[model samples]
Target: MAFLEFTRLDERSVIEYVKSVAALSSILKLDDEGDAAEKLTVKEIGDGNLNFVFLVTNSVHSVIMKQSLPYIRCIGESWPLTKDRAYFEAMALEEQGRIAPHHVPQVYHFDPTMSLIAMRYLPPPHIILRKALIAGIQYPLLARHIAHFMANTLFFTSLLFHSTLDHKRQVAKFCGNAALCRHTEQVVFSDPYQISQYNHWTSPYLDPDAEALRHDNLLKLEIAILKSKFSEQAQALIHGDLHTSSVMVTPESTQVIDPEFAFYGPMGYDIGAFLGNLMLAFFAQDGLVDQPDHRKAYKEWILETIEDTWNLFYKNFVALWDEHRNGAGEAYLPAVYNNPEVQLLAQKRYMAELFHDSLGFGAAKMIRRIVGVAHVEDFESITDAAKRASCERKALNLAKMLLKDRAKFEGIAQIVSAIRQF
Candidate 1:
């Protein structure tokens, strides 16, 4: 009944693991009674410089079995990764599910000892949102759903959910992943901008101007503004990485997965990551538009959604805060909610920094996929070189400018204005 041993797993071993997971599900009565179980087929379906993913499917049932290796398997043994990431991811999923059940996938089983996890398979039901965007189809309701998702999950899971002391305890526990945090911190805040040997964009498809833009001191200063707000905004147990790829969507459904990078980070980190990818998609539209009119139309919708999403988020967030905190006896109640001026200022400041961080991290995410090692399906799907480079450059420029002028950009209006000017 034991699954594949982590210490001795290869690609074929993945098949054995799938069989075991399927068997375990059967024992738990997950499927129909006494039906002959179908042999599980495992296929690789992940996009990143790290980790291996196996989608285990049989005739009547399907599940995902993800295993963490000691190093990047695709890159050989040169790049190291801690298998313990599975443990962190599983734990994050457990907590997030409590606050936002529909937003994340359900985890049926997990083994910390093996650094592996099995969960409900969301098959043809959902496609990665990143892929959907590259095809130029817009999810008119996505901005509202995601904004509400973030507002509810983030507000309730933070100090706002529990008392200050309880929230602090939760934060301290996740902080054990100092190594993971360091990786994100360096990737988002440090390395990409510097001329490190590790930094390089994919050839021919990279914009020389975009590459040089990362080195601008103004952009670095903008990132600093975001880094500064990290503490104040650390009021929640965030998904830590809520980008487009992390979100699964169809025309009528949206479900987010991969809280493996989840942690007690700033609420804005979640917001920024989600919105940042939209900005990435927005700028990449030009490359998708083959025609000027098409580009203008698509770009307008993207920009307008950005504005609407923020408004929806704030309107939803304030209502949640008021609903939960109004008359609730807590030491920090009046101070946190009563002062509109201060709250508005804090929110304004936070939004500005969120814009900057979104840009910086979006740039890092885009660049890393193209150059460093990991690449995204959105850009990779573009078969034409000129088209791909055009999309990447547009994204990279916005990223650089947002990071450079983060402090000066007050709200969505200014940010949108600046983006249009570019």
Candidate 2:
């Protein structure tokens, strides 16, 4: 359990491992000579696909310990992955924490050899944002908080704040996390469109829809551009899997977790992943109830969240760019962008492109969740197959339209209106 090398840790063994590490044992007050170890409890959590997460707690303080399995946990050893994702997760936590510590968990310890990391525990009442969405819980401040997070994290890491030398060095380092990036390319960008064995849907209900996607030449072309952008763009450090489940939240707190897929990629990938999942939650509301408005007004709230998230993100992101204009960022220089009018136009053009990119990426994310290997529980928990399929089809159709015509969408309000049409 307390081995010096990597071993698959379980409840009993994890306790021994924790007690062996002072930083962890200190939290539980575990003294080798005392009964403190016995008082500590270890509860395994997370339904995630890649890691083993456990909550090790004493009578008072608690800490979360996570270890990466060398394979996908949900798919098992058939799909082997690198244990080194723990290293990237640690790196991302450190960097993102530096930029937005309030939104990210603190890393107390990282053991590269063991592929393990221990960090601040987000206790009860702090639920996974996806689960909370399905449960119809609302975080009134979620939009503002997420805006601050994306704006600062993306802006601070990009050329606007970093010199080319520093940015490229960081990018080169993250290139080591190629395994996860390749996996994303497959699942998110590739598998869903082709006849991949891993792809599945509501089966007979979505069989036609899936077939339609497979044969849609224009849609395939659209996705191809996005996949290439994902492969080539190094706009900023993005939380590659910024879907709803990667977030933990309460009424007053919103914590972003799982940057295991973090990389230097298109900033809109993160923005789109978030907004796409929120859209999924919105569509799932339709099939989620036997009676209309069973959770009355929840859909409207979801719509507001989607709209608010984009709008606030736009505002905050631009604010940061303006504040740091005279700073060290290389993308836009005070000399070249010398005038007030030129700067205004540059910012407008940038935000407009980002807005469309977010829509396109968000739509792509929605497609994958429904028809790819991993499905969101929002639709899964709908119980009745027909109802769930009904929900999924609407989301699927909307996603297809967005992917093809994301450029046509002028604003978040228009996207919200389109969501209602389905």
Candidate 3:
């Protein structure tokens, strides 16, 4: 069929739209002779604030179709946003899948005009990792899988693996995604630090805490540096919103989704986002344990996962850098740093920078979630306001100290020990 004008598809219209496209029709196993709607079911499953997501399925197979709206769906037309984010998401998904196929969903279809993407549906038992964490479920393999995904994607995209020309070209491809980057800049980097209508907290309880963040000159200074890195450093192709909620998982399988915020930014942004959310879940565990059935063992799992993720990521990342030490990477030329001793020294310096970067970025991410426009379900699910505030305050204080003292930490173990302190 020819490209139709952009339409906001509903459950009913979505069926007709799918039937018109044969590939989508076949994905759902719809028979052409019968009414497509009779066999195909379209359920709106989008819980996020931006897109319209439909689970189009027959009894046999399913596909998730995501359509972008022209404005922010959560904030309405007053907060106008371009639908072009879907284009960047599609591009990012394709690149990320090429780099790490096992962790990313295959993009079966994308419609630039319609600002839509249809891809393999991640079915039941693959609930949002955040929800699983909130329920005290442990993904024993999460740290390993996430480490692989981040290491491969970030390494392959950076100058450590690509030529300067290729790296710049790849960066150019994603520069159009500046709008989403700007949104991240405002929410994660700027909004929480100042008085904004969008910013909120467990008020009265955190009223002083919220005010303190705005007035803290030292905190503001550190955030300025992180913000500069976010704005100016095109370290790698990062999954810009790589928090726990962006992941869907089971005990055995993990899949990363929703890269609409994807851009060429600091690699630490992705690492920090994931580790920071896990930290948030850890802090919220105290509030959650009030339930008779809740397990405190889950906190132990989170700590181990945090430690394992960074250690494994460090090991995997250094291994990649070593394997490609003689490759076309512009970051460290094998000829100039010809000796193994020098190579080892260079690797240490580089990894140290990345480690500190992740710490600062992670702290920034944690702080914003507590006081920014968006609040995580982990803290929000706590019924008591004072209890919720208590959890958030601990997380907030940890974040403040870490952001200021991120350079002092030499390894992930110290960070884990600090989480215990909080």
Candidate 4:
């Protein structure tokens, strides 16, 4: 019950806390073996902006404990954040894991009092997908697994599967996640556009480009439209921060983590976030193509993965919508779309809009990574400043185009083609 005091955990304190909690202590086999708790090893490995992540292991088992502080970890205590984000994270993971168990890590225990969650620790070789992409590694099943994850998670949480009454209840429950949602709205959709303290870039190189973004009236108009959807649309329960770093993968496994920012929002927001990060990875390849690390083929693979992910998601999502056309979903009544012709027409219209939404959101994600508060390691790892700037400019330009012209793009193939041209 000491955890009920709400003091932040240190190495010494975490061991004491674990010894006091049966759910965590049992996982380390402390009950079966008298000395198990004494043999446990714990190391803090949080590198993200928001939370403290510790990897705890005994001889036979390991678990990841994530604790949210009352402020942004990267920005320090001056920028306060709610530690209660852990509650929403635990809730989202449980719901999303039910829909896509294979793609999500199992949540073993969650401690709301301590603002902590203990989950399955992804073992070595299951690196973050962003790191894998940066290393020029190919995950053969990456596209298929991610597409399946997006389809199942998005469809099952949306109006396609939930009745109007149930959907509203779910939405109302998540609306309390307003703090994290506002963080996303400011960082992703707002900050990079105007002068803000958090915004930075490959400065002298992108000086004009960054200034141009501020003054571009047309671009601001488009961003305003996308921002409205991000704030207003409750189409589905989305993994709010679905960037590459949020995914852990190997040749065999792909696991999504960090739903602390999760809430009900536009489904395309999740899909676009993943695709956009992949595109950033592709752009950063040019900077990494030095010596034996020529990443031309890997760059091609990233593009292919991006194209395949969207294409497969489309196929699977539409299939789900068709299969459940007569279900409890209240989006399109069965009587209204009963005829084959109307059903086909509805499908086409729905898909077209989703595709455009995905493109626009994806483009915004890319732009933010390059010039916003948080920069991606894809470009950051490149030591040469000018070389890094070049890669970033290409990505930024491509993203701007996509944001403005996404409506013209009919499919993922066309988007892939534009990436190639850039």
Candidate 5:
């Protein structure tokens, strides 16, 4: 087979492309010496707004093949996006996999020209976390596993682990991902606050609320600050889209996928995205209720999960800081922060800021899902408009409060209490 030029792949073309690539064929044991190619099955499974994902499998082995199209999948060719996002996704996977191997999938091969990546396939019993949350299914290790993943990946990639020279090198490398970053800035921060064609809601029910959001001066001011930090703070190499849908989980195994928006940004941005989406799921539970009790216990569980995720992430992140305080980390020098009093003060101040950032960013994510272009299934899957709007309004109100007064929060417990009160 000869090397083919860049072209959008379909079900038929994927098979030929796979067979032509020795690395992919070898994964399925489908080389000239093997017969798997004759019996191979390929299924297109991408349901995202950005890429084409295929499940390629044979009788004995399987791998996931993801190819980036030159445009946004949901809006069609009218919105031209770079297929080069695949390259960034592959790079992030390799780097994040190195830092948190237990939670990241392994990459087998990458083709820059084709904008494709062949990687490990997470088989059955593994499903998107958002789907599991909607079904009210519980994963025992989800909180612990995700906490560890965030801590390791963020800590190791930040100035706390890397010297200034190394950190700058990485920051420069990811700057090319500005396009995706711009998209996030628009949808997550800018679009919701203005009258844009992409902005939407549950219609008449949320019309007034959406309008108020556009005119709220305090909310706009707060969001502008967050936007500035998001663009200026290169604190770590973050999974820029760490929502529930980006996570794949079973009772024991957790894997993160689709890091096409990976970039050097505030670590709290990543933490906030996950926590915010979980909150969306929590509020949407009202619409999913079938009994009079209205899933009270499940709601409590969701709140607890939110509290646990943040508390665990803080504990683990602080532990990493402690363990590496005397190492080559350039953020806080041992000579300057050597005393116990100073270390305690520094850690306390650092944690306080992070907590606020997480709350603010989380609130932004919640607001975006309700009024921004891309809505979450947690709210969208509900069949009843009135019920969905009610749940979304509660979420939207809570998010507004959090975004404006996040600095008042001292701990995750306080945030959880606020959610309950709302």
Candidate 6:
């Protein structure tokens, strides 16, 4: 078997390259002795910026083949991308699978040389939660599932699962990925908001009126949010980009995907990203919920999910801290070891940081969907401008409130109260 080198293959015949590059020829079962080893049927499926995702199906099974190109495919010659990104993504996904096996796709094979990944194909009934929200659908268990997912995945992957030295080693390895994270900080946060000729909004969704408003005001706010998020540097390994589109789901299941941007960064970035998208969905409920009662019910679910997610995350995080108490020594607490008041004070400080970050990132995420180039699917399908605008306004109001008073805001109760004002 040939050991693949990801950069050698040209993009012209990607499918043939994928088949030859992966371990499929030897590891995947292709029977009947002479059937010409069934070629992978591939088609593009996502609107992501950094990679090319194909739905690959063979006779026996279905899978997704995700390729990380040196530069974004859509941008073509305008910008050059580093093929090394494929290497980082493969590593990130593999680690995430280990951390949250049930909530992520199974990595069938990774061809670092070819810059491609082969993974289990989850089905359609499981759409991106953002798209589902656009259709006005609700997943009653989303908050619980996501909260657990965040708590378990983030906590264990950091200080809890490994010794301080071990965790530091992991964080250091990922920190080498600074280039990719810098790009994200620029593209998703910085560049999108800058007042420049290069940035412009489009169509029934991004009209001149909205574009000017975003350029004049919204961009500054988003940029500030991005700067603060990047500055926090709690420097733990993070998914880096966690939003509705990054997640796949059905009524009973939720799966998060696309960790190509994975790197060590502020912990709040991940939490804020997920919560921000959920808040966006809540505001867009006007277009999503068909019946009045259903709207109210779904709204409650969103709020409950927010509160429940925070609570569940706190509980699980504390459980991890208890198990790793010896390792957590001095980095976070005094030597008292069992003082209730000391523990409570530490808990208050940690939750306070979480609350602040969540609020800031949440605000940034909601506003960017309206003003940035990469919009959310929650309101993409809504044809009514008046209704959509109203929903967006509500989301914007929540974002403003959160950003202005994130540090002062205490719990889910206060955050929900602020969101309700919108």
Q: Could you give candidate 4's per-residue lDDT for residues 246-266 as a string of tens digits?
A: 999988999999999888999
For each of the candidates, give the backbone clash count.
Answer: 3, 1, 0, 0, 0, 5
How accurate locally is residue 59 in candidate 4, as Cα lDDT from 0 to 100?
Answer: 84
Error of 1 at 148 (Å): 1.8
For model 3, the local distance difference test gives: 0.90
List TM-scores for all candidates, in order.
0.85, 0.98, 0.97, 0.98, 0.98, 0.86
lDDT of each: 0.68, 0.91, 0.90, 0.91, 0.92, 0.70
Considering lDDT, which of the candidate structures 1 and 5 is the better prediction for this target? 5
Per residue, candidate 1 scores C-alpha lDDT tens digits across 282-352 of 76676665675786766787788788777788788767766766543242466665787865665556556
RMSD of 5: 1.1
Model 5 scores a C-alpha lDDT of 0.92
- Which residue pairs does candidate 4 place in steric collision? none
Identify the runs in model 5 with alpha carbons over 4 angstroms from their true place.
Answer: 1-3, 32-34, 292-294
Compose the digit string of candidate 3's lDDT tens values, residues 167-281: 9999999999898999989999999999999999998999999999999999999999999999999989999999998999988888999999887889899999999999999
On a 0 to 100 scale, what is the lDDT of residue 137 in model 3?
Answer: 90
Worst 10 residues of 5 by lDDT: 1-10
- The sequence of per-residue lDDT tens digits that candidate 2 reaches over residues 250-291 is 999999999999889999999999999999999898677777
On TM-score, who's better, 2 or 3?
2
> Candidate 1: what lDDT?
0.68
Q: What are the runs in model 6 whose C-alpha is more than 4 Å off?
A: 1-15, 18-22, 31-36, 74-76, 160-162, 198-232, 288-294, 327-330, 333-338
Better structure of 2 and 6 per TM-score? 2
* lDDT (Cα) of model 6: 0.70
Whichever of 2 and 6 has more lDDT, that candidate is 2
The stretch of ten residues in a row with the least summed lDDT in candidate 1 is 27-36
Candidate numbers sorted by lDDT from highest down: 5, 2, 4, 3, 6, 1
